[model samples]
Target: MTSSVFITGATSGFGEACARRFAREGWSLIISGRREDRLQALAKELSSQTEVLPIVLDVRDRAAVTRAVDNLPAKFDKLTALINNAGLALGADPAQNCDLDDWDTMVDTNIKGLMYCTRLLLPRLIAQGRGASILNLGSVAGQWPYPGSHVYGATKAFVEQFSLSLRCDLQGTGVRVSNIEPGLCESEFSLVRFGGDQARYDKTYAGAEALQPEDIAETIWWMINQPAHININSLEIMPVSQAWAGFSVHRKE
Candidate 1:
């Protein structure tokens, strides 16, 4: 039987790249995103390579995720991998000045949405047994802290811890889990976080050879294709231009 994968947030960024990467290997894809036009366009583009099922979904909705999984076509009933890439950062405001709505949106999409998809799709992955895996898109913010990271960082921190704990629970089941924490990739993520400011987006990556979506997709490809017995628990990626910063110090005058 051919291998299949489910990828969320497939309209753009890592999710879209992952879809194309998997399609290269003839893996049947169930790609979901809130943008129907983009989803359908992707499905059409990949259908020539392999089977594609485009689901117009927002992972934040538990009911919608459940329905999508429960109604998977016969060919996609069993899955070899689940890519939980449907997440975002809403704002870069400091915690005290940030809007509560932004925090709630991040938690809902980054944390809760991921949870709903993972829980709903585990059984399908388990059914595939060995070689099956769950790949989550975490971020460096989760592991490190910055001035305006606030809630977005916290949500990714949850992703890292959750991925680790899941490995423990799934040890005997042959279903592996991996958390991928990336730092500063060039994508629409920054635009969203900056509320569609093109200047901010350009400045964020200008002169910085930031990692591309394809790079992360390639990393994910290597991860899920590893030997069944070898599980990659956690991996972090950062561009050459990126590195840790010294601790901040405040002096009172």
Candidate 2:
């Protein structure tokens, strides 16, 4: 039986890259995103290589998430992997200056949405036994914080800890949990964070060799393709151009 993988936020970036990568390897995919057109386009493009089920879903919507999972078709019901890639960081402003609404949006989608999907899918993954895995997309911001990270960093910190806790809970169930934290990836992430400002996005990545979405997709594939007996606990990847920043010091005027 061809293994099936369910990927959230599949319209673009890492999620989209994962969908394509897995499809090329002949894995059936259940891809979900808010943009119906983009999802459909991806499904169409990958249909020739592998089966694709496009779900127009916003992970932030709890009811919709539940319904989408509950209504999965019989063919795609045997899920072998769940890629929790539906998350974003909004605004580069400091906490006091940040928009409260953006904070709420990030919390809802990044934290709560991930919890809902993982909770709903655990049983199916367990049923599939040893080969099952859950790959979460975290960030370097979660580990090393910077000024503008704020709530976005907080959300990823939750994800990292959550993945660790989940690994403990799933110990004997033969289910694997891996948190994939990446640094300075070039994607729609900056664009979304800066609220569609092309200039800001360009400036963020200007003249830097950053990690690409395909790089992340390849990393995930490597993790999942590991021997069933070998479970990767967590992976933190960063490009050569990026590194830890020195602590900020306030100077006396």
Candidate 3:
């Protein structure tokens, strides 16, 4: 039987990649995103291989979240996994000079949004009582605090702790919690962080190779597809060319 996956932030980056990868593996997908166009496009792209359901939602909306999950299609009610990949980095500026709106966006989307979705969807997984998984996307920034990534890093750090704690709490319930942290990933993260600053986005990975969305998605797939006895507690992935947080190399002339 094919497993079903419910994923937030499924329109782009790691979320989109995971949607495609899992579809290729014959998993039915429940994909949610803020952009209707992107969500529709993704659904169309994956419909050929696997069953795809696209939901236009903003994870920050608690009421909407509750309503959406409440109204899930019959097939999605049988979800085997939930991927909390719908978060964003607002600004990479020091706290003192940081934009309050940016900080709020980070906290709202990265932390509260995740809690809201997980809170609503966890009961379904628990009731299934077989084997289930939750994969949260974190970042190396969570481990290494840089000058301009104060709140962004803190958010991911919370994910790490939350995942560990949830795993222990769900031990007897047959549900596994895993956190995947990617360093220097190639994605819209930079554009979103800089508010669509083309120059800054261009320079983020100018001279070096970075982890691609596929790489992160593959890590998520592996964790979800693990043997029954094995649970991937935590995973941190960085491209071979990228060493660590804030350690990217520039072209030397």
Top-lDDT candidate index: 1
lDDT of 1 by residue, 102-173 (tens): 999999999999999999999889888988999999999999999899999999999999999999888888
lDDT by residue for model 3 (213-236), tens? 998888899899887667888888
lDDT of each: 0.94, 0.93, 0.89
Residue-wise C-alpha lDDT for candidate 2, range 90-168, written one tens digit per residue? 9998899989999999999999999999998888899888889999999988888998998999999999999999989
The full ranking of all candidates by lDDT, starting with the best, is 1, 2, 3
Could you give me the TM-score of model 3 versus the true structure? 0.94
TM-score for each prediction? Answer: 0.99, 0.98, 0.94
Candidate 3 Cα lDDT to native: 0.89
Residue ranges of candidate 2 with Cα displaced over 4 Å: none
Candidate 1 deviant stretches above 4 angstroms:
none
Better of 2 and 3 by TM-score: 2
Clashing pairs in 1: none
